[model samples]
Target: MAIQKNVLRVADLPQKKPTQFDIQPEAAQLDQITDQLELSALRKVRFKGVVAPIGQRDWELTAHLGATVVQPCVVTLAPVTTRIEEDISRLYLRELPEISEGSEIEMNTDDTVEALPATLNLDDILIEALALALPLYPKADDAALTQAAFTKPGEKAMTDDDARPFAGLASLRDKLNKDSDGSA
Candidate 1:
């Protein structure tokens, strides 16, 4: 899926100074994005970022991103709205080191570094950031699971003790105590 609504050409980046950009997708774009992400709705999305050149060919992109989204609750299926705000950063490299066939590819743990493409797609980054910020299991404010006694047709309802394997031990102990008291 081509999610590149906003594309910045590599040739347009400033070499000596950082260039800043503000991103706010249109309503249609937002609809497309929500459909792509499987969200119920996307109310708003805003991003402000700077792209600065690092050495000769490397660059870095930093942004403050915010969004309002609605998703279905995991349990009740009600719409759960959420506001997300985060700071995201990515490093662009001109060339990535080659890896051997069998060797493990060790990556940087803190910062994400990727190869610089001909054009940078800010929308793609926005989608990724929003996806990461979303709650894995969302719940509504008043949503809850209710417990009720379950019984089969023409059968009595089972109590909590009926679910335990050792419930009969307590009755046996009580009967033994009563018999010993009577004999004494």
Candidate 2:
């Protein structure tokens, strides 16, 4: 079925019957994730899969979503590649008979409200993608080099500690020595 940019309703979906639907997250959905996730630059991210409408009373819904994400490294501030595979499932119940029958949906006019049906909202699926794509520590290819410099032995390594930051300290020591010996 052709995917839409915003909310999806049972009537809008393509399927043999209203009993089930398959939800696939498209590239357009990534906008929702990048806007809120902050950490994910979202070089390119997309979700693809299906949401099936299933329930004894024909009121239950399940949506499976998968995505691939490319984010930037947090430490080196370089680009990093991340592969994300996820399946998101949501269960839905209708608050009113009209929305349940695919008649119409009403939300708080001023705020963002999550509306569900025997239908899947693309925005929610994007959120699931971001959650799965996130890394505990985002590392670029040069992350290894950054780590090695810090862990190396003291004498052989040139890191923050061994740099010229202390050149002034050495000069101060020399002046103190001269003053104590009356050589100033």
Candidate 3:
């Protein structure tokens, strides 16, 4: 069966067949998402996918997410627009691997595997995937970081070259060598 609602109960689904789903947020929903994500704008977004039973108990969801987002440039604060298209895969397992308490366990290699939930909320998955796919530091095409120095009025401002710990030592060594050669 095709699904459109935001939430789906696993027990209510047909156990033998894959269920297709498509989600497109309305304008108000988009605005809520934009605010929730701290985005300047979320003009469009869509998620379409299929959930299928794996074996007798487990399930898997595979989806494609597309979005047009706007965020401030990290350096210049100008609006930076980005088009995002991502494919997402998640496996719902009836039983997750065991990790004993107080034991140092290596991180699981597969991040997509998750414990099966009684009900799956499509909106939560869509928001999570969108959040993960967004660029951490969005930059406009012409945005650049310019350097500036700050100091007290009477004090010399420190530049990048001067900030190096050994920079002054090199000039001091050169002067010392010149003096020794002249004395010799």
For model 1, the superposed segments whose C-alpha errors exceed 4 Å read: 1-3, 104-107, 147-184
Count of backbone collisions within predicted model 3: 0
Model 3, span 1-184: residue lDDT tens: 2223599899997899999999999887888789889999998799999999999999999999999999999999999999999999999999998999999999989999999999988988998999999999999899877889899999989899998999999999999999999999
Best prediction by lDDT: 3
TM-score of 1: 0.76
lDDT to native, each model: 0.89, 0.54, 0.93
Candidate 1 colliding pairs: none
**Each prediction's TM-score versus the true structure:** 0.76, 0.45, 0.91
lDDT of 1 by residue, 1-184 (tens): 5546578898888899998889998888899889989999998799889999998898899999999999999989999999999998999999987888988977657657889999888888888888988999999999997656788899988877677877888888999999999999
Candidate achieving higher TM-score, 1 or 2: 1
Q: Model 2 — TM-score against the truth? A: 0.45
Residue 95 displacement in candidate 3 (angstroms)? 0.6
Ranking 1 against 3 by lDDT, winner:
3
Candidate 1 C-alpha error for residue 17, in Å? 1.3
**Candidate 2 colliding pairs, count:** 6
Off by over 4 Å in 3: 1-5, 102-104
Q: Residue 155 deviation, candidate 1, in Å?
A: 7.9
Show the colliding residue pairs in model 3: none
Residues 60-177 of candidate 2 have per-residue lDDT tens digits of 3334444455567777768676766555444444442444566567763532223455555566556754675578677887666443464545556655655778877998999899
